[model samples]
Target: MSDTKDSDSDSGTGRCAGCMESTSEKFRGFLNFLWNPEEKTVLGRGGKSWGRILIFYLFYYAFLAALFAVSITIVLGTLDPNEPRFQTRLQAPGLSIQPKLDASIKRTSDVIFTAGQADTYTQYTNTLTEFLKPYKENQATLNNCTNGKVKINQQYSMEKPPPSCRFDLADLGPCRNEPYGYDVGRPCIFVKVNRIIKWYPVGFTDLSKAVGNADSNAPPLKDVLMARNRAYDPNRMYVSCYDVTSGNQTYLNTAAGVSANTMYYPEDNGIPFKYFPYYGAFLQKDYMTPLVAVQFNKVTRNVDVRVRCKAYALNIQDNERMRIGYFTFTLRVNE
Candidate 1:
């Protein structure tokens, strides 16, 4: 019985050794296939087959890259780098104001704050201070255009850039003071006409001839300036602001008496004609948009008043809905 058990154990050991040898041989063959196969084939693919696939992909990607390059070149060829291709909507420029409202405030266009509180109006004064920094720094070097001569139909180039007029900060008068009159219940708001490339303001020589009659709803330019008692200047682009909350009566004769409370720096309330026909930024690198500072003195306390400011010129349109050449904002002074 012991001899029979020994023979069976020997047979089992030999069968296990044979299975281990077969597995080792199969693993060696798989490694050889991955590194280098027989019959000049690499992983079952001949050299010519690999070469054909590589060449096909190279040509396909090369053609795709060439097509992309040509498409971009053609598109860019049709555009002017310095000027806009289409300016149909920008025929007339718009208006903007300084001392913009705080970003946290929900009402963007309205200026509302308590008169005596520093925290309430400090942001407004800071904005104006930063805005005038460049003008204050560069005023000495800028070209003098105080002769009131317009630069029109002139050629400009990169080598010979167009000259920009100097807008002296000193001309702002009392509004140029550090406090800007905000601490005393009065506020100064600066109005700027947006810059349009190669656009100039054309003033009316005669209001009766331009509008075809003096009885139009649009008040004559002279009447609009009558409140301020400014003499009419046909060569200048005039800016006028008045209370819109007054009923039926024209802006000059508003019930709230806006003209009585308003005063303009450089008293004329007009932008000189020389500032117009602004060439592009590249040609007129130092160009500064002229500003009209409107100071509101002794506004009725704690009342929400709507004001509309308009820039009058023969070329500039006055469409309230479109906000072309005009801007409206609310003013509320708290006690």
Candidate 2:
């Protein structure tokens, strides 16, 4: 009888150890799924408490689902079915107003003694304004063309110059730097810019009227250097002009900066042009010159640009025949 009782006790002890091991492993897995366990999984004499806990979990999940559903419903209700509201959309703020255009146009007798003076501050404000009027309108039309549902891209008759150009140039060097534009393979450099400009307001209220026959001559910079004071020195520039991709011969931003001997090629990499998307106009013009920069920065879109071109007016006196001109007109968009 004693042996029988001892044997039965040993058998029950072995079974309890096995059951405990299995329970430990299963509970570990359950704990992994539940993250933190606050209540038990079963119910009865031992698990009536667990039953209450399970009910609590069910209520918690139901509450979370209801809150989520309510949030989604509210968001959907705010948007009109006819008016598409893209969750992911971006807009460029028309052309950023550079503050430089706010300056006065010197309005001299709008006549060119030599062809060099036609695009000067006293002359080209009227010329470029007329030339660029159509361009400004075209740009506006392109910007307004899209409404979240459709994506509109503006393809120019002229694409950004090749790997060496913002678009294709008739030639490899600065667009038409020669009297005859010839593009032989020359090493081309590229720089992209974005920034801010202060407008000083050119007085022509109607800048869009096409004025003179912009007979494509030498690039304005080339013309200025060769014509203004006739170069014996390495520092001066010839006026070189090219038609921008805006599909017009001129826009109001083109004007000549007066220099006694030579105009400076702008090298400003440290300053950022956050508000100016059209900042490349100067960069392209300056890149071909003897302008040297020790460092440069990059331009990104959608942020405000806060940079200034160190536009130095060359000191000139009439007795000195070496007056070179630099184009210094600013472009403004009225939103």
Candidate 3:
């Protein structure tokens, strides 16, 4: 009985080995379906089936790509390269004052000055230099703009527009001095008017008519023409810088410690007439907004004073709630 049981156990073990060998061969055959050129099968599908799937996916992606391209073409067709689609989006252009907020300050409109803090002031001065690089001065193109006026008559002309008026960095004068006046707690404020295409100054629309009449009663027109005549008229635009803490005055606020003095340099209170009717970047690649530097001669040290600079122009629209056509910033000097 024991010898019969031993023979039966050997036969059972042989059968199990045969079954394992058969399973291995089946797995190998299954793998061959993934890449079997001889059988014309790929990934368990015949050549015809695989070709159909490839064709289907190719057409599917091709249709998606074609739809995407058409959508982009239709969207781009609605836009005008020269004119802004939303003309009424902002009724008035904005005034940008710089030495913009330092990286540490999250608020975009405020400037903090610490007397004797070279790093803080250095960052601002460096930004000013970088911003003014395009307007540094180009003697070669100076002749293109005669007496600081570059005329642009039409839009989309194949020929390039006239060169922009030269706004040399030297025009900054004392504001360009070393340290930029922050060391002494008197920081320089640069003011630039936001560019609006085809928006002319509303206040001076009748400037030519006003210029023709020499009547003293027309003080507004006389002032406009006089401003146009002066090499650099300081009164073209009435700009006022005021200390917010002083008081809530009218539309214009005069800077504290500045009532008896003028803080504007080079006479032009702010943006000059030369940079008007902004031609798009393509027409004038080197065009830069004219910058006016306002120096605070009597800013109190270690005090926080809110400064607001307003540019009064007939064409410059103002918002009751927003600082439209003007800029407001906080000035704090620490000892």
Residues 6-100 of candidate 2: C-alpha lDDT, one tens digit per residue? 99999999999999999999998766555544543332223576677889999999999999999999999997542346522222111111112
Write model 1 residue lDDT over 32-91, tens digit each, in one string.
776564567777668898899999999999999999999999999998665778888888
Model 1, poorest ten-residue lDDT window?
Answer: 209-218
Which has the greatest lDDT?
1
- lDDT-wise, the better of 2 and 3 is 3
The TM-score values for the models, in the order shown, are 0.77, 0.22, 0.67
Candidate 2 residue runs with Cα over 4 Å from true position: 1-46, 76-335
- Sequence-dependent TM-score of model 3: 0.67
Tens-digit per-residue lDDT, 1-335, candidate 3:
99999999999999999999999999988889677878777787897897899999999999999999999999899997766788776677777887775567453656676877897677777777766655655534543343433334655543756456666666677886667788876778788777777654434444333221111111233443243353324325545555556553211123323342325655555455556667666566666766777777666666667676666566554554555755667877777
TM-score for predicted model 1 compared with the true structure: 0.77
What local lDDT does model 1 show for residue 302?
78
Return the lDDT, model 2, position 151.
Answer: 14
lDDT of each: 0.76, 0.28, 0.62
